[model samples]
Target: MMRRLLVVACVLLPLPAFAHAILTSSKPAAGGSIAAGHQTLDFQYNSKIDHRRSRLTLTGPEGAPVVLTILPSSATNALDAEADLKPGAYTLRWQALALDGHITRGDVPFTVTAP
Candidate 1:
């Protein structure tokens, strides 16, 4: 019975964890472009996130990482911020913490064009 118990444990452990805060959608999508000026950044996840514990970092063409302040929102599974962007490339890095205690991170690369 030991072998059978081990097989059952392995099958159960292989299940996917739905607690992860997966990035479902985003504004200024990956490999996308936006108009240069004041832009609102938004990120959506599959699970409810703890906005207080999350972070948004903006890296512009100059290669400086600026930590953005999270805007308050009624949406529990999203993050929002604003920044003035110049005509160049940028990467928006997002680190989110799900209510279930899982943390997820990803980078959204895009460019800004002169309006």
Candidate 2:
């Protein structure tokens, strides 16, 4: 009975990385440079966000986080963040709960230079 219970626990353990709203990819590929200052940052997720409270941050080269909250009335599949970027590498950090109730968070790096 102990052996069977142990197996069940192992199988049922939450795989947050799999279920959470993982940032599968982003428009400005990680560590890639955007010649034109990114007027917008787009994050593509493995799942839909909670929409009500999803948040995005653009971390400047100096490491200050700039908040880019969604517009609430936007589409469901995509999460958009609008920012006026300067010439520097920026890190994108995001968090959201999926429509399925899984909490997700992660970061992607990008660069912006003079046009």
Off by over 4 Å in 2: 1-18
- Per-model C-alpha RMSD: 5.9, 5.6
Supply the TM-score for candidate 2: 0.74
> Which residue window of length 10 is worst by lDDT in model 2?
10-19
Tens-digit lDDT string for candidate 2 (5-98): 6445545874543355777777777878776554767777776677777888788877878888776554665688677778887888888877
Instruction: Name the lDDT of candidate 1.
Output: 0.85
Candidate 1 local lDDT, 82-103, one digit each (tens): 9999999999999998765657
In TM-score terms, candidate 1 sits at: 0.83
TM, every model: 0.83, 0.74
Q: How does each model score on lDDT? A: 0.85, 0.72
Task: Please give the range of 10 consecutive residues that has the lowest summed lDDT in model 1.
Answer: 9-18
